[model samples]
Target: MQRYLEGELGEEQFRPLRLQNGLYIQRKAPMLRIAVPYGLLSSQQLRKLASLTRDYDKGYAHVSTRQNFQLNWPELERVPDLLGELAEVDMHCIQTSGNCIRNTTTDQFAGVSPDEVVDPRPYCELIRQWSTLHPEFAFLPRKFKIAVCGSQSDRAAIYSHDIGLALQHDRQGNLGVQVLVGGGLGRTPVIGSEIESWLDIKHLLSYLEAVLRVYNQLGRRDNKYKARIKILVRAMGVDKFREAVHREWSKLKDGDNTLTEKRIEDVRAHFRAMPYEQLDATAEAALLAQHDDPIFKNWLKRNTRGHKVAGYRAVTVALKHRDLAPGDITADQLDHLAELADRFSFSEARTTHHQNMVLADVRERDLHDLWTALQKANLATANAGYLTDMICCPGGDFCSLANAKSIPVSDAIRDRFDDLDYLYDLGPIELNISGCMNACGHHHIGHIGILGVDKKGKEFFQVSLGGRQAESPKIGKILGPSFGASEIPEVIAKILERYVELRQEDELFIDTIHRVGIEPFKERVYG
Candidate 1:
């Protein structure tokens, strides 16, 4: 780093080195992405991140759709120091960029979700250890991403990853994984195909190794645009791809890379259950009945989710407050959030792929108190899984790759739909906005997807409908031609109005789209 900063290293030589450290030269300045391994962070680590942001860059950070925190506006020369500070808390940026294995993501409610089949953190950690600095995969066709989901709901958006792992139990009661491959989103969005119905947990590492080896060998190298594993898998066809993987697996299965019971147990030990209190399961209901403040009640209902443990709930600290850009948190908020985590959630927090923070083990009795604290900090937006709680990218404002700005579009939508009662009436809707086709905001999977486009060097926005992120994930269909940025909010309003006119009782936006089609939406928006 010193050699590069001192001009001893050329741009070509320093490019990969800096990218491997998660440093990207953006439009405004250098951005540093700090990995929050599987979205987990200790309160101390949060505090450390806060301090780093204050000292190195602007006094704010953005939580990316991948569940990593990005510090924009950091000086190129000071990035090494920023990373050094991150190391104080056992965090690093290694492999966060470059054509290598990036951070493996999973359900934010991994251990606490009532619907979870197993805790996936152990396996995520295992993959992290194996992939970090692996010589063979250091330079793949392009960046590789993996997602694991232990729940039936598929909250991690597993279908949109290069490799998706779903945990399941066989008829004989043995734990195993169902593997999906070739899933990705960008210029070409392809839903992952099931490559393996079931594989014993013992062969997890060996099987993954075989898959990576196959991709490393056969994935495209000439055209960067068509280099992702998704393209290779698509070109080869699913059956042929599966056969190739099996042939490769036959050579490596049950070898030294095979996982052992003891090894799994060792990794599992690191994620032992949180120390929880034994309180009545009905305590939350009792408390809610007594609370007359409708605002607090609404926040409680919207932001908190069911937990596996009795008297405990997973609380989402919304970063999508209209006052700030989506997914952004101030340094002061980070410090206060650290304190909140310590007070309510055992000094640990998890970042969600939705760009929010999760306090996974809040006591039911302390619900009102936590809400009060969060509200005061402007962190309690009471809009989880709503239209205003949109997923957006830092577009032309920060990213050089962007063709148009994204934050303003998100702001306009949020401002246009500021009524809480109206949003609640509309029900759960995912509005994801991406600056360009890279789909960093995961626009491809949103129920209402917005992509920024360039029309003869001028900014424009394109809208899509019916996309969803869940067990039966589907890519949204583009509604029509692009519209001016100023025209977006009205366009969306018309689309929603058409849905209200056409929807069945209690039907979701995506369901309405599926019931009819994008034609209805296109007619409404264009008309």
Candidate 2:
């Protein structure tokens, strides 16, 4: 960075180099992406992030879909100092972006999920250590992402990543991984294909290394348009891709990279059980208070989630303020969250891919108290998975790559459907908005997806339906042409009217879309 600043390095040479370290030159300023390893952060790390946001950024930072934090206004020269502070907290920005292995994400409920096959965090940690600054895999054709999920339900969106690992057990009760390859979003969204039904536990790292080696060698590098691993999979077909991976794996399997029991146990030791109480979780007062306190009941219904422990419940503190941008938290709020983590969640807090924070170990009895504190901090919006709890990007306001604005569109939708009763009846929906084809906002996976486009330098919004990003990931289909910005809310309303009328007794929005298809939605909106 100093060499570039001193004019010894050209912009083209310095651009990729700086991006590998998680720095991006945005439209107005430099944005620094700080990787929070697998979305896990201790109280000290959270406080350090808070301090950085307060000191370097504009009093707030955006939590990205990759389970990382972005400070948008750091001075170029002060970055070293900022990174120095981050290192003191055992944090850095290495391999966060560019053509390298990005952060390895996993189920935020990894060890705590009730139906988990095995804890995947130890595996995730092992991969993190191996992938960081890996000399062999660095400078790949394009950026890469990996996700791991141990639960029966995939909350990690494993099917939408470059490489996905699902923990599994055979009839003989041997632990292993279900390896997937070639999944990605962006311009050409594709679901991953299973390369190996069950890879042995010992060969996990070597198998992953084999996959990356294939991608690095065979994947396209000449054209930026067709550079991702997904394109390569599409070009060669899944059968050929799997064959290549197996051919490569045959040579590297059971080598030095193979896992050992002691090493795996040592990595697992970092994520031992928290101090949890043994009492039964009646949540007695909270359930009883529900009769009179509608607000608490509403929050309880949406924000809090089930815990594996008897007395605990994981709480999602929503960051989707109606007035502000979604997935945004202020420096002061980060500080408050650090305090809350210290008091309630064992000095640890987690960031989710859904752009929310999780106090994963909150006592069920203390939920009301936690809700009160969150409300005070303006982080207590009880709209998780609701229509108003939308996923959105910074859009044209901040991103140089955006074609149109997104935050305003999101706010317009939230304002149009502000009634909690109406949203509750609408059921859980993933509504994602992207400012461009980059799909950073993950519009392709939204049950109701919105995209912004530019035609003749005028902004327009396009809508799609039926996309999902769970265990069964599917890209959304477009609903005819784009609409003027003013017409989006009514188009959305019309679509919802059809959903309300056509949905079965206990069907979700995505389920209804799948059952009925996009033809009905097209007729309602166009007519």
RMSD of each: 0.9, 1.4
Cα error, candidate 1, residue 141 (Å): 1.1
Write the residue-wise lDDT of candidate 2 on 1-527 in tens digits.
78988999999998888898899888889989999889999989989998999888788999888889988899998998999999999999999889999999988777776877788889999999999999998899999999998889998889989998999999999989998888988889999999899998889999999999999999899987799999999999999999999899999998899999998999999989897888655664455355556888899889887778887778888989875798999988999999999988999999988888888998877788888899999999888989988889988888889999998998898889899889998899889999999899999999999999999999999999989988467999999899988899999999999998899999988998988899998999998
For residues 1-527, what per-residue lDDT tens digits would candidate 1 score against the true structure? 78987899999999998898899999989888889889999999999988988999789999998899999988887777787888888999999999999999999999989888899999999999999999999989899999998887899988899999999999999999999999999999999999999999888888998889889999999999999999999999999988888899999997988898999999999899998888887866697568779999899889999999888889999999777899999999999999999999999999989999999999888889999999888998999999999999999999999999999999999989999999999998999999999999899999999999998999999899989888479999989899999999999999989989999999988898898998978888887
The best candidate in terms of lDDT: 1
Question: Which one wins on TM-score?
Answer: 1
The TM-score measured for candidate 1 stands at 0.99
Task: Show the colliding residue pairs in model 1.
Answer: none
Write down the lDDT of every candidate, Cα atoms only: 0.92, 0.89
Alpha-carbon shift of residue 59 in model 1 (angstroms): 0.4
